[model samples]
Target: MPTILTFGDSNTHGTQPMRSRSSDLPRHARRWPVILGEELGWDVVEEGLPGRTFAFPDAEMGPHMDGRIGLFIALESHGPIDALTLMLGTNDLKAQFGASPGEIAQAAGFHLDVALSDEMQDRHGGFEPFLILPPKPFAAGCLAEIYEGAAEKAQAVQDAIRAQADARDVAVFDANSVVSVSDIDGVHLDTSSHETLGRAVAEFIVAEIVEA
Candidate 1:
């Protein structure tokens, strides 16, 4: 069976909506990756951490600094990965962490390309990357201080990814095109939004992966 891996934070983790407790189990059924896997009949691995990022001010944010270290470790432990879906950047835009959305997006994009390239060479022997650019947060006044120019930042990063995909002859899905920012929390994806994302990703893979 083909395998797909999702790498990201809380939203990607599918945290129980409006939960107050820390030990709440994720609603995996509501997460896009799980839905996509079901729709496509693929093995899905959910590696979405709650407080993870590509960059952080703290030295000990997680096992990976750029998010790729842990990714490498995960791949080594799990064997081979056929596809990778990354949905991050929300936490990296927090002002408390002193990371701007532009910087976060750019740096993350770069590292993502690097990781995909390495994974392709090492695992698949060479596979085009499949990327997903998540939409801007839906909440107002939440990231205003940190991601002051987030919309623009997102666009810039999306454009760069598109260009990179073009160069690498890969595929990409812009979540902003499918899920509206007005529909959910500035950061979280509601059930409806998750459904949309799942459908979109499933469609993309069905259309692109065979030849890719």
Candidate 2:
């Protein structure tokens, strides 16, 4: 089976926005990655870390929160992938980080370079990469307080990603087009949204990668 590796944040980790962090994690069946695998009959490897940032490291969230470092590790662990998907940048909008959408996009481009490095290409035997612009954040409630103007920032990030994808000739998918953030947290995905996103991503992969 062709293997696809996904690197992302809490949403990709199948976080249940309505559930407390102390509660049991969402079941594998609820995660989009698993759903995508079942839909495509492809091997899906999910590497999602909560609070992950493309370039910045969150001391409060621990060393592993740095997506740059995490991506390297994940690449080594899940090498020889047939395709890869990246979804990140939301955490970079944290009040403390103060990163603009452009900055986040630059970081994302850097990560894309790393994933497309000679070593990675050799491992994967050369495969196309997908850059997914995560769904826009809600403008109300707790997430609003945490990521002020998140919706606008997400839009800017999406534009940057589109430009980058066009320049690099990489496949791009807009998560916002297929899914919406949960109203409960205004950040994470609900189970239904996960299903929607999984089906959408599966379709994109079939057209962009499998058929191509």
Candidate 3:
């Protein structure tokens, strides 16, 4: 069976304001890997930390620290990761460098490459990795301030992620493109939104991992 690892924040964790069935947000499963595993028949592992990002911020539970922390955990863990999906930037935008979304995404991808390289090896002990990009933040009311305009910010980040993916020769899925946000917070995925994300991700994994 293929083993996929997902690391991100609340979105990957399926966190909502209230408890609801996984079906509500089929994609954002407070335990999304579990739902995806059931749907795709793949062994999914989640290492999502709330309020974390791929880059560390300057505050406690800040983006900068949490970002690197997730990478370290993924690297140190024992498992041959067939695929890795990352959903970050929400907290990074909320905490620091709101307008530098492109730069933040570039830095995040760089660190992810480092962690994957350290963890995986080719026949000659080289790095092999798979990566996915989270969709742009849902900009509604308060979300706009948080994301500094999620549409533009998300586009910048997406461009950066694509560049890195092309350079690394890894598969890329644009989650931001697949799902639409419906919350005032702009960061959290609602039930319907989460389900949409899960379905899109599951389809990507099924096509990339199973069919391949």
Candidate 4:
């Protein structure tokens, strides 16, 4: 079966909104990654870390937040992947991080470069890369203070990511186009949103992978 390796933050990790950080939604069936796998009848390896960022580290959240390092490790362990899907950058908008969207995109580009390098391709026997623009953040209630300017940052990052995808000639999917942030926490997806994202992304992967 074709195998896909998915990398990103909490959304990719299938965190349940309004729940504690230690909690997670049932990833085997509910998360978009598994849903996509079911739709395509393919294998998916989920590698999502809450608070993950391509540019910065959350000292409070631990070193695992650095997605670049995590990607390196994942590529080493999950070599011979058929495809990769990435959805990151929201955590970079944290107030303490102080990263501009352009910088975030640049950091993400670094990870993409590493993932698509000739060395990685040789290890994976070749694979396609897909960039998924995370949903725009909703800065209200619990997220208002820490996630200030999150909507704007998401927009900026989305534009930058699209440009990068075009330049690299990789597939790009706008998560915002198919799903919206949950009103409960303002950052995570609701069950319905997850369903929507899964269906849309499954269709995208089908066209890109099977049809191509």
Query: Which candidate wins on lDDT?
Result: 4
Better of 1 and 4 by lDDT: 4
Q: What does the lDDT read for residue 85 in candidate 4?
A: 93
Error of 3 at 33 (Å): 2.2
Using Cα atoms with residue i matched to residue i, what is each candidate's TM-score against the true structure?
0.77, 0.92, 0.77, 0.93
Task: Compute the lDDT for candidate 2.
Answer: 0.82
Off by over 4 Å in 3: 17-31, 58-60, 115-119, 122-128, 138-145, 210-212
Model 4, 52: alpha-carbon shift in Å? 0.6
Ranking by lDDT: 4, 2, 1, 3
Q: Per model, how many backbone clashes are there? A: 3, 0, 16, 0
User: Model 3 over residues 63-173: C-alpha lDDT tens digits?
Assistant: 444677667667558466566676666666653455475677677677657645643543214433556576556545544544565565667767776777777767777
- Per-residue C-alpha lDDT of model 4 across residues 1-212, encoded as one tens digit per residue: 98999998989888767544445446424888878888878899999887898868788888878898899899999857999999998888888888876788888788889878999999999998898989888676666777887876678778987887778888898998889888767788877787789889989988886667
| TM-score-better candidate, 3 vs 4 | 4
TM-score of 2: 0.92
- lDDT per residue (tens digit) for residues 43-122 in model 1: 98888876666666335455454565656665566636677777666666554556544566566566456656665458
- Least accurate stretch of 10 residues (summed lDDT) in model 4? 19-28
Query: In model 2, how many backbone clashes occur?
Result: 0
